[model samples]
Target: MYPTEESDPFCLSAASATRLLTDAPWRRFASMGDSLAAGTGDPSPGYANLGWPDRLAGTLRRVRPDLAYLNAAKIGATTAKTLANQVGPVLEFGPDLIHISCGANDIWRPDPDLAEIGWNLRRIFERAAETGAQLTTFTLGSAFVVPGFPDWHDRVRALNDITRELAATHAAVLVDMWSHPVNSRPNLLSADRVHFSTSGQAVMASELVKGLVDVLRAHPVTSDRAPE
Candidate 1:
């Protein structure tokens, strides 16, 4: 069902990764995971545009237009589901940078395991390493707290722990979205209270991009010597 693409389901970064092999500065960057990164149901004027990745990509292009950015995020995707499907696309694209924001669905499940989340992450990290992409990830905020989710705060915490440990192991730059205090407020949520409205997505996108900028700046890419 999911074939590789010119406009197919899985947009591989292989050509971009290869272009990097030729010393192109823009031959880098890929994002994969769930809705937060996808900016699912982003509200812009009427819940239309302005997802985090779009905003993040805008900022990135402004700062470094050379970057080859690809976002493969799906709404309602768990970390496991992301790996199951999205990983194939990353393998194809093989860009030099990767961003991950996932695991929100697990919050709704009765019990979730951080280590299993870690396992899913390892699969992603290993794949990135294979392609020489520097991976980055974000801990999803507490979506459950919106209305029906009396347990959201706690579930998000548990998941963030797993995500952090996974990042450490994979050497990913961590974006801790859960730690944001605004999540405690109801305005950050849509009428469903689970998803962010367009304005909310903009805020979250700004938050995530800040972390990404910090990391990219702190550890500026220096190896001009393209890998063989």
Candidate 2:
């Protein structure tokens, strides 16, 4: 059941419980998903997209200067396509850490199949796990605030639940955006009211960095080389 406006089921308290990996220097970080992972909303010169992944990569570089980054996220890609196309390159990259943030596009479809979307996501997570990479992901916040999508809150809620469940089952670090108070802020969203603004991306990167820090602290990297 979806929580009411007065209720805060999706709170930051859960994020506090994310067990930290031992402090490790992540060598390679790969991102796979849709525009969110691709960093579409924020444009940069000489770069097609500069979103959260780039931001997170930049932050991670502070500790691991040799960190190799790969982003195979394409605009408009759904979970099924991401599972089919994006996952291969990620596996090929053999990253020590991975981040995925797809399925929002699927939710916007005229008639989305939540069940199939969840299945594809599970496959993607399972396959990524096989590579032995530390994974990170986030859930979507309420979409009711977005204009013309009055009833989308429930759909987004269902999707978020699926994401949370998969993240737990897969032992993936989760940045619970759905519960964050920032989700209710209008300034975080772009003019389109769907994609995040530059500031919003920064905020997301900040949250991801926090999660990554905990993961690194708990699972210290014993090797300086990428996982093979």
RMSD of each: 9.9, 7.8
Best by lDDT: 2
For 92-210, candidate 1 gives per-residue lDDT tens digits of 87677777778777667766776777678677677776776666777776544634667767777777887788788777777676756646544557667677666556566555555
The sequence of per-residue lDDT tens digits that candidate 2 reaches over residues 1-228 is 323212423222222322222234677999999987877664322222447788677656655667799999998999999999999989999998898889988988877899899999999999999888889998886532545666688778888899899899888989887867766654556656678665556557667767777776675656555554
lDDT of 1: 0.64
Question: lDDT, candidate 1, residue 60?
Answer: 55
**Model 2 CA deviation exceeding 4 Å by range:** 1-23, 42-50, 143-149, 221-228
> Quick one: how many clashes does candidate 1 have?
11
lDDT of 1 at 52: 61
Where does model 1 exceed 4 Å of error?
A: 1-26, 44-48, 113-115, 146-150, 221-228
